[model samples]
Target: MNNRLRTTLALLSLAALAGCRGDREDAPPREFFPDLDTQLKWTPQGRSEMFEDGRTMRQPPAGAVPFGRRAGVSDAAWASPWASERDRFLRDDPAYFDGTSGRDAAGNPVFIEKLPASVSVDKALLLRGQERFNIYCSVCHGYLGDGKGTVGVQYSPVAADLNSPAFLVADAPQTKDGYIFNIIRHGKPKPDGSGGFTMPPYGHAMSEADSWAIVAYVRALQAARSAATPTTGGSR
Candidate 1:
């Protein structure tokens, strides 16, 4: 063969050898661009030398407000849903979000006597409340709100009987809708001011709407119980 033909054949042989790279091996494959293959990233709970605390995750800066919607966003037709969701996240309404109209003279929260205007009492809302109650509160409060749940019987003080006179009476503080809502979300702290709760807070697992819905369902249960036996009171 000519020198050119020999050179071409040699080049073809080298190309064929290069194609035999599919064999699996224990060692990591060679990376032509190491920077792209091995990127610099901080995983969750990973250590970092850059920070003084040597933590990959950093706390939010002091005075840093939680981000919600953009500044220019308005309650226009197209942006109404977005604005509503942002407002819910912001929790700017005291009566609706915090379940308190204002604080009393002694700095104690003054819960609203009735449900806030934002919450509409309807069949759909009651159904939602029933579902949420069964999932979260029923374990301790019981499906009937009688504090006779399987887990509730095991508790030291036992869960409150939601259908009792204390909660259903018109003049009783416990009858306040906002009070119930707050209890459902924040839970009751020990009377001694010790950093402990009688009822664990469900705020983390549910949204404000769902919490309010539970309150509504509880009221419905009380009403049904009252109607079923006009003269008979609910037992604790």
Candidate 2:
């Protein structure tokens, strides 16, 4: 071919390549496979003609029960030998339900001063409590129950020291098991009701039995810490 014609052809080929390339900086690329986008489907509150009700959604089957819930179980079936008599005293005993002990001279409801009758301190119970405490409470309370946990250290307000005398009321009076159970079930709120950094309640996540177990574990930790500390006169 002639030189002029070859040069013209090269110029046209370059222009075509430039057009195909387009601009590097632009909007996001279009979908390569748009089949999913175009597929027919019914979204929430959408209508459909397949059902007699002419609605896309249908009600759940009658008597349906959610996970971890009992529907038709009887009280007799749930009762255990380990359950405290106070729990069985009335239909719902205050000790098991509200964590109350006995009323003082005042009309106020006095909280129980000890562990639930159902819970007995044993090796197995302590082990279970230890496992649960490490999983949930240890994040803020520390593995040693010293309130120096990783998250607690960085927290704005320091976490409570489970081993501290104030925690178990060691000097004035011993701490009550029911009180601890209540705290675990209903989380501790901040001094002010502002509600940002307070401990979250574990009632929903952990069962009542498990909550008791955690309380047991905390008591064990306190006992151990007390024994380890040296008295003024001699070592523990």
Q: Which regions of candidate 1 fall more than 4 Å away from where they truly are? A: 1-76, 228-236
In the order shown, the candidates' Cα RMSDs to the true structure are 16.4, 15.7
Clashes of each: 0, 1
State the lDDT of candidate 2 residue by residue for 56-88, as single tens digits.
Answer: 988978643333333442346334332333334
- The pairs that clash in candidate 2 are 101-112
Candidate with top lDDT is 1
Q: Residue-wise lDDT of candidate 1 within 101-210, one digit each (tens)?
A: 98999999999988899899999999999999999999998999999999988887899888888875677878899989988888889888997998988889998899
Q: Which run of 10 residues does model 1 get worst, by summed lDDT? A: 63-72
| TM-scores for every predicted model | 0.63, 0.55
lDDT of 2 at 70: 39
TM-score of 2: 0.55
